[model samples]
Target: MTSTHATGEIQSRDRAPGELTLRAAWRWWLPPALVALLLALLCRDPFAGDWDALDYTVLALRGAPSSMLFGRTLFIYTNHYAYKLAHALFRVQPEHAYLLFKYMVICESPLAIIGMWAFARRLSGSRQTATIAALLLALSPFFVIYSGQAMTEIPSLVLLTFGLALHLRGMQERQTSFVLLSAALLGLSVNVRESVALYGLWLVVAPLVYRWKLDARTLGLTVAACALFFVCALGPFALIYLFDVDGYRAAWHGWVASMHMEEAAHPVTPYNFLPLAFFFFVAAPIVFIALPFAIYREWRTRGLSPLFALALIGLIANLSLITHYSAVINGRYQLTGLPGAIPLVADFLLRRAQARGRDLRRAFWRVVVIVSLTALIIGTPFMLFAWPTIQSHALTKEYRARLALLPDDAVIMAGGQTVAVTYYRGLGLGRWDVIGTGGGWPGARLPELIDAHLRAGRRVFVDADARLWFTDSWRGAETRQLVALQDRYHFRRSADALYEIRPRTDATAQDEPHLERLLAKPASKLRSLVRH
Candidate 1:
């Protein structure tokens, strides 16, 4: 009877001091969500970027683009449709659809933060580490900025984080339901953004690496789960096949062709580190600093690293792939795997803080203060108020002016970077025929396309801005085509960033005197960014 009583007592002792209950979870999650929502609301008047154009196009689409989505799959249409539902339900316009999307994105911020916290707590068994990880990632610049926009990255990160948290819980409790739910979430994340499929690597590697050997039954179960994940994430698209299998498959082939390895403009190199630097170091330096230590600790602690192995693998994969495949990589492309790495880093730092704080309370508090301040500064859109970079939110004025100058009826063939302005212009004018210079994909063959459009009695206006084509996307061909198009149509610069194709050669460029002062604002912002 005494032995039975002692066994029960031991079991009770093992019931974690702060298990993730509904109330406890809400406390950790609620504040960050509110703050994120508030900030997102303040960042109104839809910022100019590729996502803005893409969202606008999606809003206007009558149906899905077969198997081709954001050059991956048609899953992003889900968010677009969600916003469309909002537009219909709320009786808001296309512009306001973005606002609705941003607000919804903000809602996920808390889930991401609290999810990170819960996962960290589970992994490291430390509440302090969880808190720091959650807070740091919540206040990350990339996460905040993307969340404030109608973009896919934030949702992907949020879903991925929450999925990891769920997966950890499922394993800890040996519950099959939680594991299935976790798989579902991770699958949803990939459909939200294809790049996030990188994190899906963990699903395969985790079971194998965490336990050196597995029985046939377990292996079979793992394969079945993966099949379920694919079906959940992408099987719904099977409905598309119910309509036109040939068209969908062709479109799928086209998108796949673009990603062919040899066609890339650049080679991968040490420059791949940019994502790690831009996404993590710029926003949360402490996380970046603690990564090595975290790796060491996980390695030493009986391969405990598999808990966050997805994060590490995903980050590396993002950097490597983007560097090799993209014409010019943006920090946003690397975001999907970023939050995954933070919890590990946070735990490592928190453990050190605990070690040092054993009789040094004031020093410990000072360290906390510094870390908090750094995160806040990094997360804030200080560049909008202070930088000359394109990321600066103040440049919406320039985009707006460009949109205003373009004629409603003209078939605008503009540069790549000018997509945001062109898309918004087309949306406002109820025209969606705007095409990209260098023909977007056909390059020099754009001249023939232009000839055909002209033959069809369309007023084709060539507006290629060499300054706007910053990336190494089909370099020489685009430059030649730009010259050919300009020679064919007398293109004259109008306003600050707009161009007009005139019938005669005598047309002089119209000037916008206000552009100089407008440029100054962002220039100042860039200066501040550099100073920081």
Candidate 2:
């Protein structure tokens, strides 16, 4: 009787916590989902808040160019078809389609929170710890901001965290199917955001670090499954490289040229440390505060758990890559690693609370509440008030309205707002050219191009204060050029940050043949003149 009871106890203890009843599952997940949904709806921005938001929007609304499909192909296509489906099924108006897309993006936040909860639950085996971790992520300003934007980051984050959860579950149970599916999800995530490649690196190194030699057959199966799934998921992109080599090359060159321009404009400095600084100080300061304690506890106990190791690896790899390569340190980049780190922080807090007794646990909960409320208080106002006031939103709205007022045949000589103006004018419209004074063109030549356009009987408009043209390296020269152009041409303020260049009454028209030749140049060639 005693032996049977002992065996029963052992089996019950070893059974996976994941096999929860439906009611129990709901209890575990519902709070985080509700909180995430509420926050996402409250913070949602009606406009594209980031520069790349409209780029992606345009690609989705219209099909992508061959060169554009070289990266983020899945994200682009998914949004494209999603919009089509919504329009077909619901008869959504074209004007309201972008708003629908934004709402679709917003829905990813709640899904991401649920993924985080599952990942933390699998990692820590404590419902309370997982809930805390989920809440932490839901409240993170970085997560909240990106969640509301129609961008790749939050969607990729959803894939990554869910994959991590499945990967952990598979590793613990020695399940080949789960491991392979996780590998496939991770591979798909890389298609959305290349930065997620580092998470795959951690998974590859994990088996060796954890010493899974005791389960040799399971380990072999895991390896083969991962290899097969990754190949299946990533093979399409490889086919693109092989089949359309020219397109791939064009995309690669475009990316490289943009990187060079950004580097020249921004200039690398000690400020490169900003990504790491933001991760530690701003994104989740409470997590960092708890991390040292977690590390010490793990070190003193079992030499650090594999869960903690995964968290550390993810955080280090992501921060290191962004710090080294990215021209600007965006706080949103840190969201890539929080799925791993938040769980560790939660586990540490819960364990410490359990060990120290009731009063200390109450104190810890109070701290968490304080931090959550603080982030909510600060983030809510910024998203509601300050975010809409960002230059991208204002500029895009102004350009859209101004473009409507301009003559259909008017030619726009654009600077920083080139993409915004181009997008608003509709892609088929061709009466526009990016100002290329800084891109190997002599400043004096700008007037000649303007004269050519004016001679062709086209009204020329300029966005003189476009921010992209005045990066640190080119600001001095660009400013001098702008000042000289303003002196020579009578500029009428057409709209915010936009000016109409009235041809001087004394100015003579340039050669008709020269004007015709200038106007005849392909739009692509004109666009290429700017660094892009």
Candidate 3:
């Protein structure tokens, strides 16, 4: 065993310096390097996740109050103060939010791999087990997909795992410094994503679980330092609470409202964990049937070790959260449970072999897990690249082709992807402006905004992605309104699916019947001039 296990007891090293250096390099550097190589292979276009075009609206605030910008105190849109931190520290323009977002996610890849390795090492107490667990995490499907996208999931996972590594080591070693760092990191992680705030429970229990004396004078300064850092880490939320208590309350209510709405989206029941289980073990999900047996044996025989407590609690907390909320869709939402769940995979493998006493069965399953994961891991990027190339080129080509239909100085109004519209506008297509529809149909302001666009000598392009608007509860009504708006404004479908909202040259009757006829037709694949 390495010196790390004994918690302040160092074993004398008989190994040469070169051997130690090589071991150190492997321990700290190799896993991260491999994760980085994987990310580099798939970081290009058709990136895994996309920026919520809605969230980007907050950039217009420029760190001001939401009330000041949008006339709302709740700030229902999370600005991701973490993302704004990039703008403050790195001079990233709000227009380039996706760029900064992708960069931040990419940066988390190596740290996340290292943290996963350390966490597995601490829990399993076997270098072999640790290596396999870290490999599972690094090769995880969601991790691979989210690594290059502008999203909060992977970033939160990185901080959560790193903090766990620190806290677990701190508990075992009775190291106040590590616990302090862990507290701070966990605090900062809450700011990154509210989902991890429950992880704070681990912070409160660690000291007593480790038997660290509260009355000890030597620990007083350490306690103070810990408190100070923890508070400092929560500085962003604290400021909001202090200065904008009303706004903070509004945000809280808004979040709860959103949770309720999400929960209402799907029929969430206790059985939700069944799918979550399947998702976590997706690489070789059949082995997941063994999870309960392994968990029961570990609990009955070994009891709940403090080492595994965080992971168990984390998994339970996430499941409890989803059980209450209707909107939990994928296993990706439950990723906080993944690091904790990984050790069980190793446990299942180790125990299965011992149960049958057949090395071949264990080895075969291990190969199956790896090969299945390999198929998913390698095939996903190829598909991500392949599907997007065709879809994007078709979409872009369609956008460009309709663009030629408009006058040269036409000012186009778009709902989403204003950046892309602006880019095409640069190629003498038309001027562009965002006319947001609250991710749905434009409010009563549509006619006024359209008239404004026309007054500026620009043909109005009313919809950016009418399809995305149908995802929520407003599907039928919004679609009906789009049809109505097309009829009312005498709009025509260009070569593509969009409506051209130009000022009328002739007063045409509203074609409500034609619009209804178009809607009643069966949906099919988009006919594009470009072939697959």
What lDDT does the true structure give each of the candidates? 0.55, 0.64, 0.52
Taking the tens digit of each residue's C-alpha lDDT, what string does model 1 give over 1-532?
Answer: 3322332332343246555553555654566556655655554324533444344344434334434443323334655577668667877776545445556666666666666666666654545556666667666665666666656666677777778778777766766677778888887776666666666666677667556358786576577667767775666556555555437657655656654523344455565455435544655567666677777765665464553575477457545554443413345565555566776676555445545423223433554566668876655554354223435334433454555565656676554544564546545643535665332445656767766776676665544443444323344445455555544555456544456554434456332212222212222333233324
Q: Indicate the worst ten consecutive residues by lDDT in candidate 2.
A: 510-519
TM-score of each: 0.75, 0.80, 0.66
Model 3 scores a TM of 0.66
Cα deviation of 403, candidate 2, in Å = 0.7
Top candidate when judged by TM-score against the true structure: 2
lDDT of 3 by residue, 1-532 (tens): 2212221121122123443232463754475447654763464324224433223333322443332212221122234465567668988764455555456667777677767776766665544455556666666655665566555666677787878778777777777688777778776676555666666766665555556677764367356545754574456665665676446547555655654554554467766665555455542242344446656655665566554465466566556655543223344565566676666565445444434533434543564466356647654654454343224423432455555665565555443344445445433345545453333235555677677777776666544354323322234444456555554566655534455675556455232224443345332221121011
Most lDDT-accurate candidate:
2
Kindly list the per-residue Cα lDDT of model 2 for residues 1-532, writing each as its tens digit: 3322332332344245544322456676788778888877776665765666777777677755234333677787788788889889998754455576677778888888888888877776656667778888888877777777778888887898888888887877767688888888888887777677667765666566566774767567667766865674567567766765436666756766766665665566676565456445456767766776766665555465666687777667556654444424356677777776788777666555545443433634764675577666755543444453343465664565656656777767555566566566444443454554333334657788888888888788765443434423354455456556755666666666556787656344221111112222223221122222
lDDT of 3 at 382: 40
- Which 10 successive residues of model 1 have the least lDDT summed? 513-522
How far is 204's C-alpha from truth in model 3 (Å)? 3.1
Which residue runs of candidate 3 sit more than 4 Å off their true CA positions?
A: 1-36, 43-48, 53-97, 207-233, 244-290, 323-327, 354-461, 464-477, 484-489, 492-532
